[model samples]
Target: MVKWDEDIYNTPAYPVTDAARYLGIPVVTLRSWLKSRPSADNNDQPALEPLIQRPDPNLPQLSFTNLVEAHVLRIIRATHGVKLDKVRKALDYMSQQFDTAHPLVMKRFQTDGVDLFVDQMDRLVNVSRSGQLAMRETLKHLLTRVEWDEEGIATRFFPLIESVPESEKVIFLDPAIRFGKPVIAGTGIPTASIVSLIDAGDEIEDVADEFDCTPAQVRAAIQFEAQNRAA
Candidate 1:
C-alpha cells in the first residue's frame, strides 16, 4: 500500500509498486535503498545528494517528465547501446520539466560511444537516407563529456527506442539492433539472411518451409531487402 502527494497533480503519481515496476527496483529493496540515504537538511552546504542517495518518501509523485527521466536513467544503466548525448539532453529536458534538484551535465564522449549511440538510434528510427548520416553525426555534437568502462565500451543507457512503440517497423533503415542485422517486425530473425536464401535461387515456398515461417513472411523479407538495396 502507498500514498501519493496530491499537491503535484500535473505530475503522474505512481504507487510504490508501480515505481518498482517502471524502475525495475523491487518494492522492498527500493524502500530500503531510499531509507539508506543520509538525511539532508535545507541548511546543509550541498543541500542535495547523488541520485542513489536522494531521500523522498513520495518519489512516486515525480513530474511526468522527471518520471520519464529517472526511468530513462534506470533504463540506460541497463541497456548498453544508448548514447550519453541523448541521455544528457533527455536528463536536462526532464530536469527543466520537473524541477529536479540535480541536473545532469551534457558531456561528449572521446571514444566510439557517440557512434554506437547514433547507430542504435538510427536503427530504431526510420529517418530518411538523406538525413540518416547527418542525424547520426548531429547526435555526436550534443555532448561535451563522456566516460567509458575498462572494456572501452560506453556505459550503456536504457529503454532503447527499439523497445518503444513507433520503432517496431521492419524497414531497411533499421539494422543496428540485432547484430548489424535487420530483423522482421516483432521478430528476432534477420531479414537479410532470410532474403538471401530466397535470392540465391531457393524457392520462396521451400525457404518458408525450412524456416517454419509463413510464405507471406518470406516475401516480406525479400521486399524489405530489395527496397533497402534500392535506397
Candidate 2:
C-alpha cells in the first residue's frame, strides 16, 4: 500500500468537473486554464501554457495541488476583475523566479510572493495604485482559507460555506482524508454524507446526533451542498 505521505497529495484524484464544482468556477473556465489554446485575436501565435497541468495528459483529472492553484487563480480573477492573460503573465514570472512549477501553493507565496505578483501585475497591466492595494488584500484573504504544513506545503483547504463575510471554516478538503472529499473540520464525516441524511428527511438535530457533530455543522454541510447544486 502506498504510504499516506508518499505523493498522496499530488495523486490525480479529482475529476475536472468535481474540481470546478469545488472551486465554484465554471467547467469551461477550468478546462481553458488546464488546456493550451490559441489567443483569441492571434490564432497564429503559439498556444499559451496551461496554468495547471494534469498528471496524465489524456485524463481529465486534477490533483489536490491543481485544485489549490485553480482556487487561487479563481480568487485573483473573480475578486479583482483581472483577466486570466494578465494573471498568467504574473504567474509565469513568479514560476521562473520562485523555481517552482506550483508557485501559488508555496507558503512563501502568502508572505513574499504576493508583493512580487502584485508588482508584476502592475507592470503587466494598467491596475491603479489602489487596485494594487486591493489585489494584495484579496490575496491575503485568499491565503486565510489555506492551511500549510511544517514543510510549507498546503495540507488542508477550507472552502467557503457561503460567499459572505460570516463564512466559516466548518468544511474542509484534505487529500489525505477520504480521498480528498469535503468533510467537517474536526471530524472525518463527509459533508455529503451529512447532507444526504438531511435530504432523506432527517431533521438537522437528528442528523447531528447521528453523526456525533453539532447541528450547526449539519446546517453548514447542507448549505455547502445546496451551493454546489446551484453551481
Candidate 3:
C-alpha cells in the first residue's frame, strides 16, 4: 500500500482552484496567499514567503499540507476574527520554535504545539480565553478529518463537504484511492464520475444503485462538483 503521507506529499494532484473550492476560500485569495509577492515596504527586503509551499514545482498545486493549512486558516478567520497578519506571525513563531516548514499541518501541532501557538498568539494580541478555546475546538474538529500514521503524522484528510451536514461526511480525499481525488466513503468512486453520470441525464437513483451508495451520497457528490465548477 502507498503510505498516506507519501501519497499526499509526493503528488502535486490538487489544483489551486479545486483546493480553494473544497476549502471554502476564494480562488484568487488562495492563489495570492500562495504567491511570494514583492514587499510593499522596500524592494531590498526579501519577498514574502507563502504560508504553504507549492506542492508542484512546475505548477501551482497544493499538497495535503496546503489543504490542511488553508483549512486551519479558515477556522482562524471564521472563529477568532484573526487577521492574516496575526496568523502569519503566529505561524512564523511556531515554525521557528518547531523547526518545521508547516507547523499547523504537522502532527506535533496537535500533540504539543496547539497550546504553545495559542499562548504565543495571546501574547501577540489580546485574545480572550473563550476565543482561545473556540480556536482550539475548531482545530479539534479539523483534526478529526485527519487519519494519522503510526508515527502520528497525517496520512489522509477526510474533508467535509460544505453542502453536507456536520453529521455527514459524504466524501473525502484519500491518497490510497482514486489517485487522491475526492470520493464517497467506502468506495473509491470519484465524485466527478457521479456528477458526470448525472450530467449525462442518468438518474441519481440508478447511479447510487450502481455505486452501491446512498442517494444522499450521489447528490452530495453532484452538489460538491457543481459548486466547484461554478466557482
Candidate 4:
C-alpha cells in the first residue's frame, strides 16, 4: 500500500464536477469512470468497474490522488484512443505486479511500468510494434507532469494550461497548497484568483505586479482558467 498522508492528498477534497473540471474531462465521462454502471448494450453483462476508487466510497468526491489518476486516464483513453477494457486490464496487471492500488501515480511507473503497460496493451489489442513504441513514448511523456515524493507517491501535478512544452511548468496542483487547486507554478498564487482580478477589470500587468509574478505568469493563469471554462 502506498502510504498517502491521510489529512492531505488522500482526503476527499474535490467533488465529482470539480475534479472533472480540473482534469479537463467531461463530467459525465468522469462520473462513469468513478461509478460502475451497466453496459448500454446489455444490462445482463457485468457492470464495468471504476477506473479509480474514491477515498470515501460513501461520497461522490475524489482525493487529489484520484484526480491524478483521472488525468492519466484522460491521456490514455481519450488522447491516445485506447479502449477502456484494455486500460482496466493493464491497470489490474500493474496493481498486482507493483503491489500498489494506484500504479500510474507511482514514481517507478516512469522507469518500469510504462513498458509493461505498453506490452500488455500490445498483447490485448494486437497493436503494431510501432504503435507499441508510440504508446510507450506517449505514456512516458504523460508521466513527466507528475511529481512524486520519497515514498514514490505523487505529490504534485503540472497540468497543461496551453499547448506548451512538457518541461514548462507554469501552473501546478499541489495538495499542500490552496486545497489542491491549480496555482502559478512557484508563487502559490491561485490561477483562478489571478483570472478573477482580470475579470474585475484589473490590468494583466497590474495583477502580475500585485502578485509579484511576471506578466507571462498572469497570461498563463488566464489561459488555464479559459481552458477550464471551455471544458
The stretch of ten residues in a row with the least summed lDDT in candidate 1 is 153-162
lDDT minimum window of 10 residues, candidate 3: 2-11
Runs in model 4 deviating more than 4 A are: 1-7, 37-48
TM-scores of the models, in the given order? 0.28, 0.92, 0.87, 0.91
Write model 2 residue lDDT over 1-231, tens digit each, in one string.
554234767788999888888889999889888988577668888888788877667777898988899989998988988887788888989999998788898899999899999999999897899998999998988788998888888888988767434346888899889989999989889999998888799999999999999988888888888888887
Q: What is the C-alpha lDDT of each candidate?
A: 0.43, 0.86, 0.77, 0.86
Q: What lDDT does candidate 3 reach at residue 167? A: 62
Assess the local accuracy of residue 39 in candidate 3 as a C-alpha lDDT between 0 and 100: 62
> Which stretches of candidate 1 lie above 4 Å from their native place?
1-95, 98-177, 185-187
> Comparing candidate 3 with candidate 4, which one achieves the higher TM-score?
4
How far out, in Å, is residue 130 in model 2? Answer: 0.4
C-alpha RMSD (angstroms) for model 1: 16.4
Summed backbone clashes in each candidate are 9, 0, 0, 0
**For model 4, what is the C-alpha lDDT against the true structure?**
0.86
Q: After superposition, how far is residue 23 of candidate 2 from its true place, in Å?
A: 1.3
lDDT string, candidate 4, 135-208, tens digits? 78887887888999887889898887676566788999898999898899879999989999899999998999
In terms of lDDT, the poorest run of 10 residues in model 4 is 1-10
* Clash tally for model 3: 0
